[model samples]
Target chain A: MKAFTVEQGIVAPMDRANIDTDMIIPKQFLKSIKRTGFGPNLFDELRYLDVGQPGMDNSKRPLNESFVLNQPRYQGASVLLARENFGCGSSREHAPWALDDYGFRAVIAPSFADIFYNNCFKNGLLPIVLDDAIVDQLFSEVAATEGYQLTVDLSEQVVVTPGEERFAFEVDAFRKHCLLNGLDDIGLTLQEADKIKNYEQQRKAVTPWLFADV
Target chain B: MGKTLYDKLWDAHVVDTRDDGTSLLYIDRQLLHEVTSPQAFEGLRIAGRKPWRIAANLATPDHNVPTSAAERTQGINGIADPVSKIQVQTLDDNCNEFGVMQFAMGDQRQGIVHVVGPEQGATLPGMTVVCGDSHTATHGAFAALAHGIGTSEVEHVLATQCLLQRKMKNMLVQVNGKVGPGITGKDIVLHVIGVIGTAGGNGCAIEFAGEAIRDLSMEGRMSVCNMAIEAGARVGLVAVDEKTIDYLKDRPFAPKAEQWQQAVDYWRTLVSDADAQFDKVVEINASDIEPQVSWGTSPEMVVPVSGKVPALAQAKSDVQRKDWQRAYEYMGLAPEQSIESIQLDRVFIGSCTNSRIEDIRAAAAVAKGRKVASSVKQAMVVPGSGLVKAQAEAEGLHEVLLEAGFEWREPGCSMCLAMNADRLGAGEHCASTSNRNFEGRQGFGGRTHLVSPAMAAAAAIAGHFVDVRTMVEEA
Candidate 1:
């Protein structure tokens, strides 16, 4: 996990609604046990003209030049601008892992599916929800300007555009704290390990069958 | 105020709650599968952590397991794809090392985690269930507080047996009248998703209530709750009833004798109070539900089996118009085209969403005497689990399907996610019983029309969509 206070990076516009996890990282890539190396195949179907299989060298694959990330203008982009209902299908954590591995630090969208949103925080990728109108403006700005950059300050919960315009966002406080410090949730939960142990003991007495081996 | 079922389930599972409204909810059961659990297990090994309660977890490989008997003959070694084999092997190795009970590939009990859970009585009323897969909501059919979690949360639940969470708002999707003769839970849920759109249930726990829901069998109820994720709700629930108790009665893991009576007594109280409040309520008439078929990528891009592909002019906004246009391009269909006229190349009648015995029976009933159309390249039936396959075979359902030109295959997730060898080819169209019709969900560049088991079977016979109700009347 990586700590995040702020990041200033180029923005890539994904001008579509309901961009599902399948489009983010297709099911084929999910076969890997290890999480890394997903960067090369992020949005494999949309990024390449041909089918993507694991272990295929991605560089030599024909590029879908029309894809937002494949275009030269969006090269090396770290901020993703998306429409409503982004990351809408599947609870594959691979979606977030692929986004993070693909050099994206944050995603700005009007809305996101719940599991995908939760998964993003877990993987140290920031999913910022803003007003639909604001997202529209961001999308427009990124399209009109080449190499558009935005400064995302997690500490202040504001996204600052290149022109110094700032837009505020809301996030859960505890989640914010975890993001700031790059904390492992297991360690945090373990601090209250005694509480968990006691609860299990009490639960065992009430639902004995649940504790019994099958 | 009277508590809703969601409130009662949430309250019962609370180990602690902070001022921020984040509750440390104790998970009573955790279901694991190959695709998502490996990373969590890897994380555990890296951290030198052990699972909080060894007995609380149940694991199996489904997502990447080959479903063909010939390919699966060697068991894990028979899996052809090396990458997929490793994932299944990793689950086997981790479960062996961690001492978690697992139903290996060849085991009759092994199947999709959601199906295996209820069948084995690993899921029970009042339990707080979490799985790395989204369809874990299927367990909520037993009146459990169940939802999907990501790999990180999987690891967290593995280590602490608790999840850091916030309460979701309560929603009631009440279906008032009786469902039509041919309507199944698959039809009702798809109709609900069409009405709600994909994001309608976001941030809320939807309780499928009213007369119609109460009327469904335990399997039908499971089918409804299973697709709650497609409706944009992570948790979908049904109140406990006689069906729930009856389904759990003789299961291997269910409580026995006096304890069973006690459990049933407690479960009877698991329903929402008569005056319980809901933040949102959606009233639907069951008669309004028609056999459904998804025409486009998303599950919500659906219509009645007799309906037509939506015209771009019908889109409500620029975003919707663009989405509709993209769907048309990807699906290679014109606006206002009748759904029944859409030909299919293949048919798949299996998925966690509809692979239980009831679903298989419904499909078999349709395929009993009808021959699959010549235009249909292939039609396959992959039962949900080994038990389901055996039971179907005992009933001679497999013979009926085979005689009708449908391949009777072994059990696993199969083409539902296309991680295994079974998948759709580019430019091919399929009538699938699986949940999602998202682009490439079945295979890259494959177009999928989501339908019920009977509907899928009917499509295979006709080589196109047809009203299953009409077929029943003709028979």
Candidate 2:
């Protein structure tokens, strides 16, 4: 995981709501064992006219000219501006891997699906939740400006727009800490291994059947 | 204040709670399938960690396993697609190396992880279950606190058998009144998603209670809870009952005689207190529900079979109007177009959501004396697992399906995710029993109308969406 402090990058606005994981990274692309290469097929259905297969040359694929990310102004965008319920389907972490792999450092949305939201934090991709009106304002600003960018400060917990508007967002404290430090969740949880074992022992004593090997 | 079922399950699973309200919730069971587990296994190997509790994990190669008889003859080697074979083979290798228990591709017990879990009694009441697949919420039907996790969290749970979690608000989706004839849990859940849009249950663990919910069989309850993720809630619950106990009675992983009694006694206490409170409540009359079909891309873009494609003007907000407009263009349907008038190229009657024995029986009942319409290119029934396949075959349901021109294929998640040999072609419309109708879910450029098993079967025979209730009445 990469540590996040402050990321300032061009904003790409996906105006539609309920932009599901399938739309983010389609099911066909989910076949890869390695998570890193999904960047090429991010939003495969919307980004490319041809059906995306795993090993195909994505760079040579015909780009859907009308896709927001394909537009010249939004190229190399790191901040994704989206509507409500972005990443709404599937619990595929591939969705986050694709976004991160595609050079996106953060996503600003009115809301997000629960699993996708959690998946983002694990991958060091910040998913900032602001009010719907605030998101609408950002979307408007990004669409109106040619080279719009937003500064996402994880420590400050604010998305600073180009117009000098600082909109604060809420993130879980533990998640914030992990994102800021780029901490491995496994390492953090393994530190409390003794506590977990104690709880397991007590639970076993109360319900021994659960411990039985079948 | 009395505790809700969600509260009871959450309280029981808390290994440790931090000041920020994130608890280290102990996971009692995990179900792993091909697509998600490979990456997690890779992560574990990179981190030099083994599964914290091997016995707690149950795995199968479902997502990418071919359902065709010819393709399945040689087990993993039989998978036709190279990429899919690698994904499934990775699970086999990982499970073998990790010494985790698994039902490999050829194993009769092997199927969708969610289906195999409850069928094998690996998922039991009061246990906290997690899977790499979102449909893991299906296990919550047994009063378990189950939800989906990402690959990173899958690896996290592998290294430490606990998930960092905050408590979710409780929402009760209480369905009252008797459903009309031929109504299934699929209908109820689709209705629920329609009543509460896709994101309605976001941030809440929804408890589905009331007479209608209790009236559903264990399989039906599983079907309802299975799509809870489609309803935007990670956890979906139904309190413990006689049906739940009866369903788990003598399964392989179930407790022995005395331990079974102990387990049952504990499971009995898994329900919500009588005076329990909920953060939100949604009341529905079961009688009001009809066979549902998703007209558009999202699960919330659904209506009864009798309803039409909603006019753009009917969209409550500008955002909704855009979504509906996109759906209309993609689905190739006009506003006010009748669902029944929509022709289908294929019909799929299997998935973790509806491939259980009961679902198979319902589809078979509808297909018994009818031929699949010539306009329908294919109608296939892929059972949830080998156990479900054998059960359906023993009941002679497969014969009825085959006689009706429906392909009675081998058990796996065939066509559900299009990871296998079964999938829709571009511009093809399918009446499918799978959960999501999202764009390109079944196949690239494929249009899917989500339906129940019976509805899908009826659609196959009719060459279009027809009311399953009408077919039942005709019979």
Candidate 3:
């Protein structure tokens, strides 16, 4: 987990609505346990012309030039700008894992599927929810300007555009603390271990069958 | 004020609650499958943490299992795809190392995690169940506080035996009136989703009640609750009743005779109080539900099988019109086209939604004396589980489906997500019994039409979407 104060990077526009998790990483690429390698296969079905399998050399595969991420202008983009209902379908955390692995630090959408939004916070990925109009403005700005960049400051809860315009965003205070300190969910939950152990002890007495493992 | 079902279930599972609105909810059962658990277990290994209670976890491979008798018998060793083979092998290894009880390959207990959980009586009323898969909502039909968790939360639950969750608001989807004989729970649910749209149930825990829902079987109840996620609801449930208790009586993991009486006594109190307040409420008439067929990529793009597609001009808003236009382009169909005129390249009659014995019997009843049409390129039946397949074969359901030109394969979630070998070709159209109709769900460039098992079987013979009501069993 990397503590985040601010990130200044290029933005890539994904001009599609209702982009599902299947479109983000697809089902075939969900097999690997090692999360780092998924970067090359993010949106494999939509990114590559040829079919992708595990262990296949991605450099050998032909890239789909028509894909927005594959276009030369959006190279090394760290901010993903998109439309509404992004990351719908399957509760696979692999979707966020793929996005984070793909070097995306923040995803700005009007709305997002509930599970995907929660998964992002726990995986060191920031999913910023902005108004549809603001998202539209960001998309057009990124598309119209080459090498467009935005400065996202988590502590101040604002996004700074190239023209020094500031747009404020709301984030849960607890989540903000975790992100600022680079604390993963497990690391945060383990702080209250005694309480968890006591609860388990009491639960064993009431629901004996649950613990009997019969 | 009286308590709602959501309040009751949430209160019972609270291990602790923080000032910041997080509750450490105790999880009674954790269901695992190949696709999601491997990475969670890997996270545990890297963190040097051991699972809190191995006995409470149940694991099996379903997402990538081969659905063929030859492959099923040979087990994981016979899996050909390198990625799929590793996913299955990792689950086997993790289960072994963690000492978690798992129904291994060739075991009759092995099946889709959701289907196997209830059948084995591992899911009891008023319990808390969580799984890495979204369809885990299916367990909520038993009056449990069930919902899907991500892989990170999966690791957290594995290590702590609890989850930090915020309570969701309560909603009631009450259906009144009597359903016709041909209307199954699947029809009722699809109709409800059409009325509500995909995001209508978001961030809410819904309770399906009223006279019509109470009359459904335990299996039917599961089917109705199974697709709550499709409506974007994380949790959906029905109150426990005689039907629920009767279904749990003799199962292997259910309580013994004296304990059964005690269990039923507790379950009887799991319903919402008469004066309980719900944050949101939706009402429907059961008799109004028709056999449904989806014409587009999303589950909400549905209409009665007898109805034609709506014209783009009929769309209520510009956004809706744009979505419909995209669907029409992807599906290669025109507005106002009769659904029956659409041709099909394949028919898939199995998924977690409709792969149970009753669902299989319903399809068999339709395909008893019919042969698939020549225009249909392929038709297949993959049972939900090894136990389901065995029971279907014993009742001669397989013979009926096979004689009707359907290929009867082994049990697993084959083609539901096209993660394995069984998938649709480019631009291919299929009538599927699966819950989702997301674009590229079955395969890349494949078009899926959501249907009931009987409707899927009938479509295989007719080579298009035809009302199953007209193709009733011959007297």
Superposed model 1: Cα runs more than 4 Å off: none
Stronger candidate by DockQ (1 vs 3)? 1
lDDT of 2 by residue, A1-214 (tens): 8999999999998889999998899888889999898998899899998888988988899999999889999989999988999998899999999999999999988899999999999999999899999988888888788999999998999889888999999988999999899998899999999999999999999988777663
Which pairs, if any, clash in model 3? none
Q: Write the per-residue lDDT of candidate 3 for residues A1-214, one digit (tens) a residue.
A: 7777798899988877677888888888888877666788888887999877777899999999999889999999999988777787789998999999999999998888778888888878888889978887897788789999999999999999998988888777777888888987777677778887787788667655556473
**In model 1, what lDDT does residue A28 have?**
92
C-alpha local distance difference test of each model: 0.92, 0.92, 0.87
lDDT of 1 at B144: 91
What DockQ does each candidate score versus the true complex, computed on alpha carbons? 0.79, 0.85, 0.59
The whole-model C-alpha lDDT of candidate 2 against the native structure comes to 0.92
Tens digits of per-residue lDDT, candidate 1, B1-475, equal: 8999999999877888877778899998999999999999999999999888878899888998988888878899999999999999999999999999999988999999999999999999999999999898899999998999999999999999899998999999999989989899999999999999999998989999989999999999999999999999999999998899999999988999888988898899999999999999999999889999999989999999989999887899999899999999999899999999999999999999999999999999999889999999989999999999999999999999999999998889998889999999987999999999999989988999999999999999999999998898999
DockQ of predicted candidate 2: 0.85
Give the TM-score of each candidate. Answer: 0.99, 0.99, 0.97
